[model samples]
Target chain A: MSTDSNPITTEAEEKKEEVYEAEHVHKVYDIIAPHFSATRYKPWPIVERFLREMPAGSVGLDVGCGNGKYLGVNPSLFMIGTDRSRGLASIANHEFKHEAHVADALDLPHPPGRFDFAISIAVIHHFSSPERRVQAVRSILATLRTDKENPGRALIYVWALEQKNSRRGWDENSPQDVFVPWVLQKGNKSKQPKEKSQKQAKNLVETEVKATASPSGDSAQTRAACEPEEEKKEAEPNPVYNRYYHLYKQGELGADAVEAGGKVIEAGYEKDNHWAIIIPA
Target chain B: MKLLTANFITCSVKSCQSVTPALSFRDAELAREEIDFSPLFLRNILPRIDWPLLQRTAKELGFPALPETKPELSPIAEGDEEGVGSEEEQKLLKELHSLLLETSVQSGKLVCANCGHEYPISQGIANFLLPNHLV
Candidate 1:
């Protein structure tokens, strides 16, 4: 009964924590890919402009090209897309009809100078560490075509820690780590009795949310098992899945891009995001 | 995975570009009809195609021979204009178009010449997940 007899050590506990952190991000993306894609159908104007202005027939790369949204902006430019998510990559190739691969942004499959131009939109910020973020940018830079006459360029987008809207901005004093909210929707089941229609169902959902937040005790599976069979058969309530985000302050991304051996051409904020354009140095 | 375009992929290992004839393609799927072939579009794309490397790749892929050297860009006024070039040049363009756009690696492995990394291509999408040592 001695607590000191526990087999787990600090190193093992820390490793487990690290694994959980990584799982949190990857699992969230896997679960939300479809919902995320549906709302992201429109290509951001700046990204559209960047792709459109790329020289005709230049080879382009779209890193983290979820659903291959901007892959075919310029048909003349042969483009390749990649994403860490296998589901997204499959959607890119089969559904969107774009050439895409399932690859990590930090370690791209293509060799140096493979692309005339490259872009990583809203991707680098997902890295757990600052060093990894820089590595991700540099890795993409290496694949860019670096001829002097037509030096290749890269465009990157990261979430901004500070925004014009106060509600969206984070405190400058704290680390730029935060969790943004993602709401998961489960369709309402029609099998519920007619008397328990809308109002009663909403009340039940609210009560269920409180019950799931149990501070006192049982494991999640235990709690689920304890629920009544009839309740288990009912439509599940919507759950908020908080997503981890590493926000960058103004000039932060540009500085990292430069430190990673890129020459920053432009850096600024748009909406709740900070974006930059750089050329490999 | 059309073997003809394998030249574009290189070793994923650090500090190794690897020599040609290093990476080999297998089970290439040629489906160029899926691409919209516009002469104007292809004309602009012609310059970026590494002719020597592409020829070598095509040979490896078991496709018919490409011209010994890269063809000069057709001097027709507008790529879309009729009588854009002579019959010989037009024939070359059509061949180049098929070689570049139509060929894809649907199911295969892209083995790195130097580090021996095997990047698998399944359902026309390459899974380039490298182990921690390589990363």
Candidate 2:
């Protein structure tokens, strides 16, 4: 056997490497895909709104769609459960895997404007930085693009189940983990791209943060923070969304993300203690 | 609605901005996706792709693609073996992103090639459109 004979195969094998060495992440929901039927978990009502509201049969990009619990709840919803671990994907394929795919949620592969809705659950907190969480949410929303025909194509993203003291955060009280559902629609296309300056976008972010911080929608601390007459701008004053949805401590993700996106349309949190901020969709 | 080609339209919770990368797909900058032209590009690009997402995307974008098991890189073709650098095997890498990335097929009834669901791509968007009758 000469060295030249097997070079290609050897080189090809280098692309795919096993990750999360301990398999800690993979073990969590490896078995859930099979036993995840709504008949079992009984969390279907929370996820039902998502199914009911969404345009029937729209492609759902499940970020960390563990074992297709949402799929088990509603199999008709064409789901693509994505996970970083192959073990979980294999188990998903065996049981509730409508179409189990092993991939990173952060770097989703579909062309820009792919899915009608994106649902991510109990995943973002795992990252070690506010920037990572921010980037992750932005990446998922990237799937939602403007609709050409509808003029205001709505993109729903329900980022429920945030960890309060996520081990991923820098400090125990870090305000990085908060549910901020995003909806990007059309209609607002008339305004040129340059119309809304970076200043306005920055201000919107600041206002969102202030609203979250002040329970009554306005407060003295927020007033002091908002006033610009004499105050100097803190280069990064609450860049992350600190207010809005209540953050769940660690692991309280009761609802499926796919269903949550669906909820944005129909009931609008009529039941769940959760209500979305309702960004322009 | 908006024609965004190489330029990307990025949005945060508060705003949306369109960006265009400086890199042009010229000979000077052979894209990692140009693996079909040379295997080295495949070797380099594979590491950068969100493998699992890429795999899911492969399935999502009309190909039942799977993420790599690990970060493994190797030569697609041996210039020494063929007595020439064959740009054949890496074609998948070149076309994979083009098949997956550059092309955005907006507005159609996207039927899952596998599951047989009629997902509508309405308004330059694709959503798995199930019916009330199904629900």
Best of the candidates, TM-score = 1
lDDT of 1 by residue, B49-94 (tens): 6677777678867878878987787577665464347767677666
- Per-residue lDDT of candidate 2, residues A143-195 (tens digit): 66445443112222333233233322223354533323111111222122343
**Superposition error at A114 for model 2 (Å):** 1.7
Instruction: List candidate 1 segments past 4 Å from native.
Output: A1-22, A164-171, A187-235, B1-7, B18-22, B27-32, B78-84
Q: lDDT score, residue A74, model 2?
A: 50
Model 2 chain A weakest 10-residue run by lDDT? A15-24
Listed for every candidate in order, the interface RMSD values in angstroms are 2.1, 15.3
TM-score of chain B of 2: 0.35
Worst lDDT window (10 residues) for model 1 chain A?
A208-217
Candidate 2: tens digits of C-alpha lDDT, residues B1-135: 111111221111111112111111111111122212323433443443445544443454354544456344344454444222344434555554354333444444433333333433333332321232332
Off by over 4 Å in 2: A1-40, A148-281, B1-135
